[model samples]
Target: MNAQEILDECAALYTLPGPPKDFGERTVSDRFEPAAVPTLITNATIWTGNNNGTEVIHGGEIFLEGGLIKYVGDRVPSHFTTNNRVRSINAQLAWVTPAIVDMHSHLGVDSAPNLAGSADTNSMKALIQPWLRSLDGIDTHDESYPLSISGGIATALILPGSADAIGGQAFIIKLRDTKDRTPLSRVLEPPYSLLNGTRVDPTIPPRWRHMKHATGENPSTWYQGTRYNEARKLKLEQDAYCAKAQAHQWTGLPAQIPKNLKWEALVDVLRGRVKVNCHIYETTDFTSMVGLTNEFEFSIAAFHHAHEAYLVPETIKKVWGGVTPGVAVFATNARYKREAYRGTEFAPKILHEHGIPIAVKSDHSILDSRFLLISSKFAALRKALKGGLQGEIGQWYKAVAEGKIPLVVDVAKADHIATLLELKAEVDEYTGKSLRLTLTHATEAHLLAKQIAAAGPDVGVVLRPARQYPTVWDQKRVLPGPPLSAQSSVGVLTDANVTVAIGIEEGWQARNTRFDLAWAALEANGTLSRTEALAMGSSNLETLLGLEPQTDLVAYRGGDVFDLSSRVAAIISPARGFVDLI
Candidate 1:
């Protein structure tokens, strides 16, 4: 198969043999019906999702009636408490927080156990597939759901895998269902408007190194193929279709480009109906795409895995004049991939100071859904370190080839890069920076407690457990948490009071990691406050994703030191009503 064949397949998404049918709204089809029992609670400390615990309710009692919080205060509503239909509970001096929301996960779509049939996150046949969706591939039986729920996670935005340059669409769904699955009913928000993809260079599979194995047509085509060629061709094709669509929208001419669904989705982005969520790294993709989006008129929603986003100036004066990306970053465990060599945990601090919101991502399956909360903790901590030696990107490859890291198997394999630049002895001899700042490892974010406090809320972080990489390294599943220290960064992110959230980067694989991260933060002296730790697993996660209402909560022991150290967990959810999964 060739590029023409791939284009032909895309064309099929537009037309069918018969005319379109418009069965206008009449009766709903198997519509959802949430549980009806009203729940009441008395005596607990509650966080109302107001930024930074500003509107916390002390000794609060809540009336959760009809799938929503009817009242939240020190006293429960008389009618709710008196009504025979409402159920009540005496809260055990616990802290009540909004349910955890993992914004970046591939739960059902990538269903665990590491089986081939269940792995539906990416579509390898096409480099650009906006039509693919996480919805169609979701398996309600994925055990990660129940496990994550036990950790107080109530909602997740399941997304497609980042295989091609433009993988597919994502959907935000509730993690609940009756004994019988509803037909297309579990979707809380369908077509979540994120076209997931990645720009990281090392994630490319080794088999695709040969031209014969790199074609986008099938997996067997043998033409002279390269992702560079594919990426270039895709941009041209998308520009052509989107430019025409813009003309139709602006001029009302040519009757709308023959209604191509693929082009139609791209046009939705062009017209601001959707946003692109690409797994990004390095300043090149950031700077280049900023220009690309300007030309296409489609704004990026969030740049996931933007390890080098901090290097991108907040305001860049390009050849045209200036560019404002106005984009958020779902920053993840960086400094692992090649293009992400310059990645830093302090990216959030820098990006925040530059005015960009940062969200932590587990890249589930990369970290595990269970540890999503910790990911945020670590990102904030690492970035808040007082002072540290930064890595120089221009001199990275030289250090790597000189056997500075584990990424390169053989130092002799240097055909691609000829000659190298000399680096300062301090940064290069691994004296000023950490040994972890090598090509395969991560960069350090070292700053004093006062320095981190001064960085302030300007930096927001989404962190995962430190150095927890599973199913990595040529598909080998490496699972072992790293040892913690007093100088850990997780403690510092909290000192700055940054808005933080967590993700289950590697869904089922890292489910237990969230607790591991929290434990590390709690034991680390006076760095992470108990309130901030619990908030990341709850309201902080919700706020980062712009979740609403401040309902759907979890209960935990409340006092001077609040923690997820709860041996028992209780939750309130929009779906499944009020039930403790743990």
Candidate 2:
């Protein structure tokens, strides 16, 4: 659509009823199809994406129809058999799990991520440019979406680039390779912020500088040599223009408006409603942004690249916000002093300990999005081994509490939940298994992660899928209670028992290619049990995402999976047949 037409459409939308006054408006119920072909997978270990839990079955068959899981157990009821055409598969080799959800992304919207030639990525014209929208520039034809689809990425929350202090809003999009397809209606609300620019304010109160520069004949000569005067001139013009613009907006009067798109965006931010996901670093910037947020009453959803998040954990805890940092990305002195750069790999762990809500994102282009699972696992391991940094995920949750930071509640060993945390352990524990064993373990891990991540902290099963792709049937929470940490650990054995004839750990390598220390967990090299390890990846990661309870369906290729890659690759759906994972 043309720019004029887009604006006209937006204007017409604004004239309609605004957001609902009730909190119920936030999440609408999902619409399910009634009649669907019945398909059955028999005799397989199942990970009910219900908790930090998995149930191993020798011969289990599940009935699926109308896009909902009718039954997931050892026996299929007879009623489902009478009316529908049943296509049964020997699932002894397959591990089925929910499709992956990428909460933070720039796919399709920013298209190509690099800044060198992309004007669509950033708006540096002003400090607080909120008007810039990534959706306005989404190249739906971009190949990134197709690449993500290969990794079983079912949905992505496409956000604006974080080139500025205030990036534009975010939109959730279904991963589709169709020609001009309509996306699902239940997208997360778009949040935005303005990128602060380097413009100085000319209206500074001059005190000591005037005294020093006062000469008998010349005035304020002390500041003459620097480019301060030029900066001040630009600042004055910007301020005057901003005043005129604000006045005009209030009165609908003619005024001098800035031709700059960046400035125009900031007006939306100041008006509130748009949530800001800032890309900030320094402590000073964080403080300033908080001040701005208070002045405008807009919520700060998160601090995108908060390398300095550790510096002001207390302040962040005050506001219900989050941080999505590149966990392993440590800065080099070549770009800036390494001392100024705070890394993110362990930040989530630290924040969790200090009470913060944490979410992990690939932040990479489409092709490599699946790698996010590995990246998050790395963070979990580093934090867990470091002793003092325990409960890092919990700290993040503390930071996101709406009221005062709650005191740390004593959680049992069974309470330790994070899907990433559990996966790291499960993948490690079953290191050198047969292709079938590996497949069963990986399948259990993926499903457990989904369940733990989908449920919130109340159940102690951490499984927060991306906010965009969370199950929304009737908008009601339908997930069952999660298994305790101990139960979750024992659950892996259930899969291993029937999947393995002798149930011996002798042949398992304890380490494999997918994850780095996963072998130790498999070999019992580490004190943590295989179940405990899986809990870290499955339940812990879920808890970190605030999705403790999950209720969703995942379909995978029928077979014994050696690693996560194979399982991720075996997706077959009508829109995308045989999802490609390279």
Candidate 3:
């Protein structure tokens, strides 16, 4: 469809973006057809993707039929196995789990091989083009599909690239390769989000940034980015637009002027029906975005590429008006861009401590889709190191609270300062870093870290199978120079707390090689346990993506079943035919 016609149709879709037509105007619900057959798998190891707390059945049995999982546990009902048509397989040596789900990707949109012609990642005509749908521009023929599916990726949330501030809508899709033909057959959900790009670029000259999809746009700019009041002023104008949109709710009255597509999209966010998976990083953006969302009474589903999330734990915990967005971070990547250079790998740990769930994305080719699990492992490693630091603080605070150390309340006490310094010295040495601590800092930095660590976990994470793709830059790189130190920390994000799932940010770029990433996670280092790493690649991802209660399973051979090159044995579907993984 031509741009003009597309806009006209979108404008006429005045009823607003809703769920599947059969479901009415309720919420986004699963619309997948279940597997058609009833099958029993006996004596298998099952991983339920709940990383904060594990639910593993060492010798489990399950019944899957009609697409959904009817049961999963240590034993399957006898009646299920008795049915003649119900196939039974002894999967004692194999592990059965849900298919991996990619949270962020540009699979069909960007297409594979990255040619300019198929490079339809953004609707760059203007900064606030929420009506633009990634669904409208997808190419199923992108070779990324079959490869990604074999790598154990079943579902994805595909999105437009981030060039303009408000790029377009994100769409959800199932990774079923039908020779890349027929868009409707592959789509699982569309309008996953009405993309809201933060930090609109003033760098793009006004002449090149005017609206092109509609007529009568000769004079005014979509965003007036004057030299003096550029970012903040422009942001304020955005807030005003959001306010207008939120208040422009429809009552279907004849007197009511039909709200335009842009306003309606913003209204969906404000009403919390749709999530704004925003593109953001810097601490400043986090603070400002939170305030803006609070002002408009909306919530961010997540903040994409939140590189500096560790800097504002308290700010994130404030929870102004609605639920704060999860911090979608790069796994082990940092220091590439000035704004992204700051935060530590432990940002996920820190954010979790502040009551924010974490979501890790590959950012596709930037961090390589295969590294999604690899990144989560690094986050886990960072969390372990931070926990060690907190352990030291906890010991020190115990002495102080127990009155072992005199509570000196006044004037500069040299001994007290020196004592705290000594304690911090031990912590820095143990955790391997220099933390700029002061008496004026919050207790979390001092005593609060001990307090919260003592209490429990802050937030569990969601598994999205995309990442920022690994990169090593000089100026933009994070501190503590050794690259291994950054990548090798792959164990326990605080024993039985913190969650993870897969989010594929750039599928086409990685050609959907998710299992390879899973292999990297498993073999990354000593920090990540075998089961934990496997979970990150498989079950943790499915659960995090909210695709649980599924009977679909992936079965593998070899003790090293999750190995990237060929761990996959078969893809078993109740309704669908078995697919070979290798």
Candidate 4:
């Protein structure tokens, strides 16, 4: 209402947004815990997540002090030895690297155990709601926090669910629990003016803010209309409001800056103050969004669940400001819905070849953030195979009969075993002898491992989730591993000469992948080596999904990361500027 207030509001409107001027020069992290003591870890085999994920150090040392990585190399600084407060840790040749960063997740917003009021992922009250924030719904007591952290997840970008065209704002959070025990405490780089009542200082650059947007089925299906028309109308309204405020038009007596709670965030997008992450699939959706961005004169940060992005890299490059939005996708998760029907495992490789930045993500709860790294491994593997080995119909039939090409059949029920047998018989009758066959999610395949193994040499079983649970009617006869039974399905199948591989069924199960492989190998009783177990969880998964290599890292102690005897000792996080001891 006053001259000073009006001037301050006008100055805030035009000030460009970015990190503060002194952000890069800071020695201590904003999240530095005062109680955290300095630590020195030595003698470790570190997978530095560098050189395209191929760089490895046999013996390395890392120093952690003042909530930052003071040093990392083959030797520690001489000054560290003189400090009495510094703690020393012997890694015993264990693996170490930067902590994992989950590119897309809904960890705290959609808490685990599926309780009645746990989920706050979406809102169908309106089609467009850019002002809504995921922070308001974050459950600090989320059960997945400790579990995901134990799996080496240090940070995750908590995104709002794609239930509407413009769902809401997203916030990045660190997994560690702070002494404050509040959601705000866990937030990373929150905008300086968000909670402050005082006017924003014009001298400092504002921090970047994130918003969630969607295209295609999700928005249309929920709102029963196209998002373009509605969004355009909103944009026009925002332009009018901004134009009036900039012109100092006084429709009311006070002459204050015009403000609309609902449209403020969307208006910021046009001003290039918000980084938009759009959930899109299919070529049509991608093109539509690209056009939207260009017309609105804003840039999208990335496209999440962009199943068909690989098919339209050129269209993505056409986004406003000449920056191609990164494509975040799943490794092998696809086709459960109509929109994802065309998704392929080779998408990452295709996008990478086209010069698009690619990242593997877990739609958490949808994919489990703990095993986020596994998705990358899967993507890497799929990239190597380049859409897998295929043959002509006639050649395939001959290879199958000759036990060369394996036919993978998904059988969850014990009765499905009969169907598999019938298919095998049909193949044998059509060709000569049916030999090559593999069963995935074969919950009860262990009961007939002898018969399946007798069918062929390449015959094998893949136990998804690595553990069995009676989650569905068909999986009721699950062979509960360990305490419940001496030998697991992996043990039973391997004993009959049927090869076995461990896998995950859900997002939460992803974090437990290492344990699953370790358990499978343990039950095999000397049949599987430590390296073989590690491959099942890492290399084999990468081969399956076609994910790109990551630069983040994790640290293990006593043994290999995948070994049952080993444990996560610390996280050397270059991104967070601290080595978090566990």
- Cα lDDT, all candidates: 0.50, 0.42, 0.51, 0.76
Candidate structures ordered by TM-score, highest first: 4, 3, 1, 2
Measured with C-alpha atoms, the lDDT of residue 347 in candidate 3 is 80
Ranking by lDDT: 4, 3, 1, 2
- Scored by lDDT, model 4 comes in at 0.76
Per-residue C-alpha lDDT of model 3 across residues 1-582, encoded as one tens digit per residue: 133333332333223344334444332234434433477888898886667547777888888765557678778777656767798889853667677777677787777878887878776586657667777788877877777775567877776776655566676778774443577557664332222332122222111010111101221222231111232343354444434444553233233223544454554444344556766666766676566556555556666777776887667655445466566777567767676668577788888877888876655545445444533443333333345235676565444333233222111222233344444444456545443222221111211223323322311232222232223221122121124444321222323343433344355734444554454364344555657665755666444333454466777676355454446667777646655565
RMSD to native for every prediction? 24.0, 22.5, 23.9, 20.9
Superposition error at 557 for model 2 (Å): 66
Candidate 3 wrong stretches, greater than 4 Å:
1-36, 81-83, 178-181, 189-257, 318-320, 371-582
> Measured by C-alpha RMSD in angstroms, how accurate is candidate 4?
20.9
Cα misplacement distance, residue 166 of candidate 1 (Å): 1.2
lDDT of 2 by residue, 376-448 (tens): 4445443433222427764543342221222122211221224333433443344321111111112123234
- Residue-level lDDT of model 1, residues 135-212, one tens digit each, is 778887787777777666777767677656556667667777754584145665332122233212222221100000
Worst 10 residues of 4 by lDDT: 379-388
Q: TM-score, each model?
A: 0.49, 0.42, 0.50, 0.62
The better-scoring model by TM-score among 2 and 3 is 3
- Judge candidate 3 against the unseen true structure and give its global Cα lDDT, from 0 to 1: 0.51
